[model samples]
Target: MNLHVIDTGFFKLDGGAMFGVVPKSLWNKRHPADENNMCTWAMRCLLIEDGDKLVLIDTGMGDKQSEKFFSFYYLQDTITLEQSLAKKGFHPDDITDVVLTHLHFDHCGGAVSLNASKGNFYPTFKNATYWSNSHHWEWAMYPNAREKASFLKDNFECLESSGQLKHLDVSDWIGNGPFPWMNILFVNGHTDKQMIPIIKYKEKQIVFTADLLPSIHHIPVAWVMAYDTRPLITLEERQRFLPEAVSNEYYLFLEHDAHHEMCTLKDSEKGVVLDKTLSLDEL
Candidate 1:
C-alpha cells in the first residue's frame, strides 16, 4: 500500500482558540500570530492507494462558500485538490472511498462542489462512497449552537442528497472496524464519534491524528482545542491515547499543522514530547 500527502491549502484561525487554555505567553513562541491574531494552518489531507481502493482521507474546505464566509478564515491554496490528485496519477472519479473524520467545514467541505453544469452542489467524487459515521452524520445534520457555524450544510448536504454518502457502522467498531489493514479510533471529545483512521503503512502504524491531535504542539495532553465541546473529555482522551501511541510506535500524520507534516512522539520525563518531525516521503 502507498500513502500520499494531499495538501489542499492553508488558512488562518485565532491562535487562542486553537491552543485552548494554553496562554499566548507559551503557544505564541511556537505559533506566531499575525496582526489579526490568526495563525495559519494547513488543510492537509491524505490519499491511500491500497490495492483497488484509492481512498481519500479528508477534503480541505471547498471553494463553494460565499466570499464573505471565506474571508473569515483567510483561505489560501497553491494547488487544487484535483491538481494534487493528478500529480499522484489519479482523478476524482478514480477515488473509491472518502473517509471523513468529522463533518466540520475544513475537514469535509471539499467533499462537495458546485456543479457548473447543474447550478447546484454535488458530490465531487461521483464514483466514490463518502465515509462518515452514523453518529457524526446526525450530529452534523443537527449541530449544536456552539458548533453550528463550523458545520456548514453546503459542505456535505449534497453527499446524502446525491445518494453517495455512507455512514460507517461503529457499533461493531471493536471488531476490526470494517477494514483489514485499517482500524478506526472513535473519539468524542472534539465532536461526536469522530473516527480517526489508524492505517498500517510500510512497517509502522500511521495514525491520522485529525482534531484529536491537530498538530505536534498539541501533543501535551493539557493543550486541547477550545473548540472541543467537552474539554474535560478531551483531556481524558489524550491521557489514554498518548501513551498508547508511544508504546505502539505510531507515526502521527498531522492534518492542520502547516509547519510540520508528520511527527513521532516519545515518552519524555515530562510526558509525550515530539521525538522527530518528518514528511510522508520519509516513511
Candidate 2:
C-alpha cells in the first residue's frame, strides 16, 4: 500500500477556539497566534493507494463558498485539491473512495463542489463513493445551533443527490471496519459520530487522528477545541485512546497541524506526550 499527504493549504481560526480552556500562554507556545488571535491550520488530507482502490481521506474546505464566507476564515497558501492530487501523479478522477471523517465544513466541504453548468452543488469527486455514517449524516443535516455554522449543506448534500453517498454500518463505528486494511474508531465528542480511520501499512498502523487529536499540542486530555459539542466527552475519548496509542506506537496523521505531519506517543511522567515527529516517508 502507498500513502501520500494531500495538502489543501492553510487557513486561520481563532486560537482560543482551537485550544479550549487552555490559556493562551500555554498553547501559544506550541501554536503561536497573530495579533488577531488567529492561528494558521492545515487542511491536510491523505491518499491511500491500496490495490485498485485509490481512496482520498477528508478533503479540506473547498473554494466553493462565497468570498464573504471565506473572509471569515482568512484562507492563505492555497491550492486546489486537484493540484495536490496531480502533484502526487493522480487526479480526482483517479479516486475511487472518499472517507469523510465528518461533515464539518472544513473536513468534508471539498467532498462537493459547484457545478457551473447546473448552477448547483455536486459531488466534487464525481467518480468516487463518498463515505459518511448515517448518525453523523443526520446530525449534520440537522445540526444544532452551536454547530450549524460548521455544517454547510452545499458541502455534502449532493453526494446523496448523485447516488454516491454510502454509510458504514453503525455496528462498524467502534472497531473492525469493512475495509480490509483499516479499522474505524468513532468518537462522538467532536460531533455525533466522527470516524477516525486506523490504517495498516507496511506492518505499522497509522491513525488519522481527525479531531480526536487535531495536533500534537492536543495530546493533553484537557486541550480540546471549544468548538466541540461536548468538551467533557472529548476528554473522556482522549483518555481512553491515548494509552493504546502509546502501547501500539500508532503514527498519528494530524489533519490540522500545519507543521507536523506524523507523530508517535509516549507515556511520559506527566501524561501521554509526543514521542517524535517524522515525515510519512520516514515510516
lDDT of 2 by residue, 105-168 (tens): 9998788889778898878778999888999999999999999999999998879989999999
Extract clashing residue pairs from model 1.
none
TM values, all candidates: 0.97, 0.97
lDDT, candidate 1, 133-224, per-residue tens = 88889999999999999999988988998888877767665664556778899999999999999998877999999999999888889999
The per-model lDDT (C-alpha) reads: 0.91, 0.91
Q: RMSD of model 2, in Å?
A: 1.2
Model 1 accuracy (lDDT, Cα): 0.91
Give per-residue lDDT, candidate 2, residue 184: 86
Q: Could you give the C-alpha RMSD of every candidate to the true structure, in order shown?
A: 1.2, 1.2
Off by over 4 Å in 1: 176-178
Model 1 poorest ten-residue lDDT run: 170-179
Give me the displacement of residue 246 in model 1, in angstroms.
0.3
